[model samples]
Target: MLRTVATRTRVGAVRVVQRRNASNVAVQNIESRWSTLSTAEQNTIAKQLEEAQKGDWKSLSLDEKKAAYYIAFGAHGPRAPITKPGHASKVVAGVAGVLAASSALFYAIRLGGQEKPHTISKEWEEATNEYLKSQNSNPISGISSEGYKGTGYVVSK
Candidate 1:
């Protein structure tokens, strides 16, 4: 008997709290004033919505339906844009700046680097082929081969 009384008291307390938190705002103009509502007001409206949805769905007002849809899919929370205006242009400019800087650095290194090796010259490569032929290197299919008409390491212009 004591447990039943305690349970009834808790249920009555919960109902009183729910009633206190329920908003008096009419659902008809909720769409227009939703953004201006305070957080507490919004939570009250949400509670009202929960109670309304627990009953007959066909009895809900059109305004309530629209409010529910907007609350679920509105661009005010996670769906909101994180970037400011002109974000794409800013990103493109950043990428271009990085590309230009890298190109400049590459050209600076190339221009200040050591000269090409002497072995890269056509004359040096031809002399190397002759030396290899004299050394009988790969006699079957290389510099010392018979009728080997292929260019042998002479690639410089």
Candidate 2:
């Protein structure tokens, strides 16, 4: 019974090792796919991502983001092969048109939603600016500006 138990433990360890090895292989496959991209292609995609980030891509809808990602990813890929009677090119063109339309729609909607933006009140902005200015100019002397208005006080003798 002891020998049988030992054998079972060894088999279990071997199975664990095999699963780990399989996972490693799968990771390597993905790594190879990423590595297959040329440096120039990666640089282009990186630039696209940078531009998208700077252009407020966070406001994009899910479908718009996906479309942009695909367009950026496919920028350096081989052109789709021409099909009989230009059908393939037409289909590709149709997809591109759809993407273009969606992009325009999303862009308009994003811009439209920004017309009446809620902004900080004048009072709050003035207070914030005064606080920042005081912090910058005087470390020890706080409260550069008085909280209350009115310049002076008078009293009867």
Please report how far candidate 2 places residue 121 from its true position, in Å. 9.7
- 1-157 in candidate 2: lDDT tens per residue? 9999999999987875565444334333232344466677546545544444454565444543543455456423464334567797989999999999999999999987855433345555566656666566433443344443422121111
lDDT of 1: 0.78
lDDT of 1 by residue, 51-156 (tens): 7777677866677777777777866657867998999999999999999999999999999999988778889999988899889999999878999998887887
lDDT of every predicted structure (CA atoms): 0.78, 0.53
Worst 10 residues of 2 by lDDT: 148-157
Off by over 4 Å in 1: 1-39, 56-58, 126-154
TM-score of each prediction: 0.54, 0.22
What TM-score does candidate 1 get on C-alpha atoms? 0.54
* lDDT for residue 101 in candidate 2, whole number 0-100: 100
